[model samples]
Target: MTAHLSRRSLLGLVGAGAGAYLLSGCSGDDESSDPNAPQTINWWHIQNTEPMLPVWAAMAQEYRTAHSNVTIEIQPLENEAFKTKLTTATQAGSPPDLFQSWGGGVLRQQVDAGLVKDLTDDVQPWIGSLLPAALQPYTIDGRIYGIPFDVGMVGFWYNKDLFAKAGVTETPTTWAGVLDTVRKIKAAGIVPIALAGKDKWPAHNYWAYLAMRIGGLSALQQAAETKNFDTPDFVAAGERLKELVDLQPFQRGFLGAEYGSPDGQAATMGNGGAAMELMGQWAPSVQASSSTSKKGIGDKLGFFPFPVVDGGKGAGSEAFGGGNGFAIGKDAPASTVDFLASLLTVDNQRKAAQTGAVLPTVREAASGISDPNNKIVAENLASATGFQLYLDQAYPPAVGQQVNDSVAELIAGTKSPAQIVKDITTVAKSQ
Candidate 1:
């Protein structure tokens, strides 16, 4: 109960300033009691792409300069690769000292398995400086398990020039309008969307947003609790996504495309080969890094909230996404937390924000976000009426993967709308 915000109120303090909501909990030996000690911190993160990759390295080097006692070994892995490797590592009961964490069901499972470090005492003193809203995802059962550095929601990252060329005058605000927009864009001989089907997870955003719009935030919570996703709402969400899929909206050979590959989703958008892609805050930076010119589409990139679904229970104001954080592993030296704290400092947060690739979790660094696209996302997130962490990060790993698998098959035309729900439900029930 100390976490304060449950899954239902993840964004309760988004626009408000509040004290840190993480309260006291059971304890472990205070590893951070020592001021200086020779230690090697093993860090694994998924900001392997440029812009962020260099930014993270710079931060580590800065930390090292401040404390010569630490030798930090860094590994920047690709998203899918990080997930696969992390799973294997955790199963083997060996987790990196500091590793990237999305902080929801996965963190909870880690906590339950005693694989994660209890950071309640380690983080509370300085946690108040960060956004209370951002902390909710990392808090489980009255203890702090991780600390978020970036927070944002999923939305459409579109190429304005392509939209204009397609003669779509405005961004769609309804599901029907989005379909119409796609049709128009496609007819104009432009790929309506740049999708990374080989990655599977990118395609899942469409279905997740659709379900959020049609079923409401409560429906997702209910399904998670009941382990049943066969409801009419979910089925309709799938069918609606199918309507867009059948329009042949994505780039050619999209099903075989990778997300950060040279010819993949971000690059396609950056190269002006597509009108849009559903993604989170980092889209623009990734686009720039993956693009041929390494400058991306620059100001041509724009963002919009996922469109509303008419007659659906969810409001357009609700957001679906998650942010990035670092969790300490069970056996990490106490200096690990001190090092983590150093990275989350307001000055460091401001530094990260100025790169325009991150949305600051520490309130003081909010002014550092100068990228207009990121600002748009930040404003929308601040005013979000509700929030849903990405489902893959919200549910148990197995259940979450099932959602990605089933939705990807639906997008690939290998699974029916009804069958995808049945399959997801089967996995959920088993879990």
Candidate 2:
């Protein structure tokens, strides 16, 4: 339960609506003012694979061509490696000129240490071009700190063919309905869900979504603020998840399953070995990559928002997820901000969206999405009633890791729901 913001409140933060904004401010006119200014922008990002890796490189080359005096040095690292390297760099007080950022608790820590620049004034002129919800993660204390390139939410990525076989004629819109669907799918000899239990973060999503649905969007935030997750709503969230676990809907050896392995959650779902998975915008691409055919069950794939719980304080429209963005280091060249702006242009964003690898943050770039699933996700995010960043990202890293550990224990049948909540509460208090 990250801090929640209503759509109207988010819109107000941008001053103007997204449709009215333009990318005029992002052009390198300031660099042009001083033609011979030699500035090398050091950019570190995590899109180290195709088609995004090459796409990003091309964008950097294009930028360099436009501003002859500026050289953009791109360091594309793998996810874990990037985190490790960035942590080392930041700790040594030499953060990259511009690097990948997810925003929320981590970004907050960076801000506290004065490792990142405040982009509020620099980006305000064109910030509105991005969907308001997309900016929620990058914003701290109502101040903008990063520029988002992609945004999305978590939801059910299901197999329509499997549902049909299970006689589930309609998508479930309530928690009870979801259970019924799962039971039916199990009865039909299909694995109801694909879970990467070995990867604790994946299991954490279920408990987090349950909390959001039961305790409302602000529940996690309230718990974090008070360092108390032992409330009735949090307990109920665990109990409800327990009900799902008791059904044994996941695949064989699910507790040890990885996410992208050949026999993991994505592969299981991609190969049609499991009926559904709860994941973010990147699900389809990963599924395809992990499948035996190296091509997922394409048309059979479908998506739906997580179901609502009876008598819950939360609505069906509150979204839970995060996105990719770039944060500027404290001493980055002035032109670094401009270069970031250039990367988020409608044209560049549209190119990224075309790869089906990202949900473009720029409103105008959304039209470039040709995939129906991506379109559905984008539309759902656009109309989301409330926005919450992923719990692992929204809270301190220690607390977040505790959440993943506690939830994994609950799923493994070793810890009671009440006990898990108490464990999480203890970690939050320590944080």
Candidate 3:
């Protein structure tokens, strides 16, 4: 069930009908030099951090100024709550004008439910301009549906200073090596890794990271789309996960820690209470903004690709990620659509990237970024052959809830891998 979109074929479509318009027949008020000409777009997103909150607010203000008639009413929601409200709103036929979405299971489910708009025409001409990894999830059954805003990879983020203290000369490149490295780090009196299991999604991500290494990218996709947990491929992934858990690689009380924000937990690394963390590329942003900003530890951060699981079928470079993007709602006015399209243009996307958000969606924009770490992350995301969407976003909301519960149980040693897989498969099969 893997979907394919070759660069050449996508380029040909762009050339043949590049001028077709999705904005046609859409109308808005004609007034002064205003981009916001009285259009009200209810935009829902969960960006509640000092760095990003102000950044997005400023962007919204700029957007409103350009379109005098348009105003994006920002509705901030918690991650778990947002999903619930989104479902209720769509079911009630009164969803927001534009909402934030992470491509993968969530976007797929929304599109399948007819809760989102298709942007095939608007996306065609700019199709080739995007990196392959940034475009795949938006396409379903050969139709493009949304635009990417932030695209990033999951990786190992380590503290160079901590590594030095532990007497580790180099980062590990294989799962076996990582385990050995973890043992040494712990024996040296430092937390090997910091994990926030309270956030179910991060817990699931740990499993997905291991699954991709255990089953390979294609096999993971097959199991997901086909709901075939009986395959030895997926079973092996579960076993590997159990093995990692058996090692007790995480900090004490990690199973109950919250992860949606970096506020309180990042102090572990800020104070050298922990050595490293395996998370999205955006993780550095948290460390950079930590209480130790005055201590200069931010500059000492290092990143590595997720370690390969030895003897596994997966590629060493394979990654798991989700693209954050904008989508037009069914009721959005034509002018609003125009503003959205223009906002995501190369120039604006470049600013977004520079301002600390990932922007691989627009190659021209990504090229302008000066941050070396971000640049490396952006490049890896671009060259990615395939992506594993965030598990919560990929499955039905109920199934996602089950996944969270399963991971919690597994981590708590209350549920066996076989039982967890069976529980998830039972619900996944229904979907």
Give the candidate number with the greatest TM-score: 1
- Candidate 3 lDDT over residue span 1-431, tens digit each: 11121111010101011111111122443423344345556676655443444555566666666655565666645555566777888888766777767766767776777777888875566667776667677777877767777788878778888898989999999988888888888888888887777766667777777778878887766767787665666566667777778878787778766553333345455555678877776665555544454231556878788888888878877778676776666666555556567657787777767755454477777765666667777767667666777777666666777877887788778888778878878887987
**lDDT values of the candidates?**
0.84, 0.82, 0.66
Q: Report clashes for each candidate as comma-separated counts.
A: 0, 1, 17
Model 1 Cα lDDT, one tens digit per residue, 1-431: 21121111011111111222111121233445454656667788776544555566677777777776666777766667678889999999999889999999999999999999989987879998989889889999988999999999999999999999999999999999999999999889999999989878888899999999999999999999999999999999999999999899999999998777778888798888999999988888777766788788999889999999999999999999989999999988767898899989988898888877789999999989999999999999999999999999999999999999999999989999999999999999998
TM-score of 1: 0.92
TM-score to native of every candidate shown: 0.92, 0.87, 0.85
Task: Supply candidate 3's per-residue lDDT for 286.
Answer: 53
Per-residue lDDT, model 3, residue 364, is 77
* Ranked candidates (lDDT, high to low): 1, 2, 3
RMSD of each: 8.7, 8.7, 9.4
lDDT of 2 by residue, 141-252 (tens): 9999988898988899999999999999999999999999999999999999999898777788899999999999889889878999999999999999999999999999
